[model samples]
Target: MTLAARAPVPGRFRRPRALRSERRTLHSWLMLPVEAVARLMTITWNPVDAFFEAVFWRDAKRPGKPFHGGWNSMAGRLARAVVPRTRNGAHVVMQVTGHHLRLAYVSSARTLTGAPGAVELGWYTDLRDVTWIRDRSDVVGGNHEIGFVDGSWCSVHFVGDGWSRMPDAFPLRLSHLDAIPTAR
Candidate 1:
C-alpha cells in the first residue's frame, strides 16, 4: 500500500483526559483565592524561621515559642467574631506561652486565615490538650479536624500554614507538608 506521506505512523495513544474523580467543584474553586492568600501570608512572615533562631540561642524579635495557628473555617470565623467563642474556641493565631495558650487574630481575613484548628480556652488547660484529628479519608493530609474538649469540632481543608519549626511542636499537630512521617 502506498502512503500519502513518507513518514512512519505515530503511536495511537490518546491524550490523557482529566480524571472524573479529580474534577474540581464550585466550593473548591471558591476556596482557591482564600488558599492563595493564606500561603502568601506565610511567605511574608514565616513564624518557623524565628522559632528556630530562638532555639539556636539566636536573638529573635519575640523570645518565645513560635506562632501556632491557621485560618479558621467559615464556622470558626463566626465563632471567632463572637465574644464567647473568641475567648474560648475561635483562635486564628496562637502562641504557647509558659502556662497558657495566647490566641490572636489578624485585622483582616479573620474568618478564614489558614488551616483550621480549634482549642477550647479554659481556666486550667495546657498544651497537653491541644488536640488533633487527622482526616483519614484525605490521603494527602490536607484536611484536619480540631476536636474540642467539649466534643465539638471543625474541619479545615487548607494546604497548610508555615508555622512549624520543630518536628513535634507540643500538641503533636501536623505540619501538613513540613512534617514528614517516619518510616517504621
Candidate 2:
C-alpha cells in the first residue's frame, strides 16, 4: 500500500496513527510534567496529598467538628452538582488559602456551579476567632486547572472566605503548562 493509504496490516508491522494522535493529545499533556518531575526530582505542587494532609487529617482528629462537617457537607454538595449524569464519576480537589478556597474538577465536559450554590455562614469559635464562610472564586496553584482523560470527569469548590477579603490581590494560579518538559 502507498504511504497515504498505509495501514497496520495484520501480519505485518506498521505504526498506528491513533497511537500518534494519543501521544500528541492528552497523553503528552499528562506526561510532560511526569517526565520533568522524574528528571528534575522536584514537585511544584502536591495538591492531592497536600489537601489530604491539610484538611482530611485535621478533620479525622476532631470528628463532627463544625468546620470539618461544614467543609464535608459543601464538598458533597459540589460533587453532586458537578458530576455528570452517567455511570462515570469525578475526583474533586478543594484548596484553602489565605484569601479564599477553591475547588475544580477534571471532567469530560465543563461543569460550573455559579452563585446559586453559593452559601455563606458565620460563627464564633471558643478561641474568640470569628469565622466567615462562602464560595469564593479566589484559588491558588493548580487548584483551578483541571485535567481530563478522554471521557473522565473532575471538579473543585471553595468553602470559606479564608484569611483575607480582597480577591484580586491574591497570588495563586494553576501550574503553568509551558514550564513542563517532555518525556520519551
Candidate 3:
C-alpha cells in the first residue's frame, strides 16, 4: 500500500523494443462525471514537479502488469476491464522533458486552464527542433508528425506502442520512418 517511483522522460529508451515514455499517471472511471464536462475542457499542467517510470500491479495470482515495455492482449486485457477506454477523452497528459515536449491536462477538480491542471489546447515541442514523423496505420490511427523549429507543423494522435517507441526517444530520420499500412 505504498506507491511512488517511476522515471524516464529525458529522451532515452534506446528502442529495439520500447514502451512507456514515463511520467504517466492516468485514471478516469468517469472522473466525477467526466470532470463536470472535462473541467470545462482542461487547459493543462498541474505538476509543479514530476517523475514517474510507470507501474501498475495487480497480481492476485497473475495477469495485471504494465511496467516499462507495456503492450498486452488477451483480448486487450478482457476488453479493458469491461470497457473504459474513454475513446481518447481521458483528459490527456504527457511530459517528455529534457527541454520540452509538453502537452497537458489534469484535473482532480482543480479546474484547468489558468493553473490547477490546465492546458486547453496546448503543444510545445522542442524535440530537438522538431521535423519528425513515424506514421502507422491499418485503419487510420497512430501518428506523430511534428515539424516545428518555428515552421509549425503538427499531426499527433499516436496511440498504442507510440509508434514502436519513437526511435528510442528521438533520433529518427530515414525519412522519419513509416511502414505500418497493410492497407489504410
For TM-score, the strongest prediction is 1
Tens digits of lDDT, candidate 2, 1-184: 0110111112112111111111133444566677777967755377888778777675566332111112123322232333222112223334434544443433222224421221212111121111222222233321222212121112233234442332222342223332211111
Q: Which wins on TM-score, candidate 1 or candidate 2?
A: 1
All candidates in order of TM-score, best leading? 1, 3, 2
* Regions of candidate 2 where Cα sits further than 4 Å from its true position: 1-67, 70-72, 77-184
| Worst-scoring 10-residue span by lDDT in model 3 | 1-10
**lDDT measured at residue 95 in model 3 versus the true structure, 0 to 100:** 52
Model 1 over residues 1-184: C-alpha lDDT tens digits? 0101211222222111112222343555677798789978867266787677758645344332111222242223222322221211222343456554433432212234563333332222354444543332233233344333333333433223643221234455554343322212
Candidate number with the higher lDDT (1 or 3): 1
Indicate whether candidate 2 or candidate 3 has the larger lDDT: 3
Q: What local lDDT does model 3 show for residue 108?
A: 29
- Candidate 3 per-residue C-alpha lDDT over 1-184 given as tens digits, one digit per residue, 9 for 90 to 100: 0001111111112211111121222444445577677766754354432112112322432322212221122212211221122222324444557776554433322333544532242334465754444432332344343333333333344444454465345544323345312211
- Backbone N/Cα/C clashes per model: 2, 14, 9
The CA lDDT of each predicted structure is: 0.35, 0.29, 0.34
The alpha-carbon lDDT assigned to residue 138 of candidate 1 equals: 31
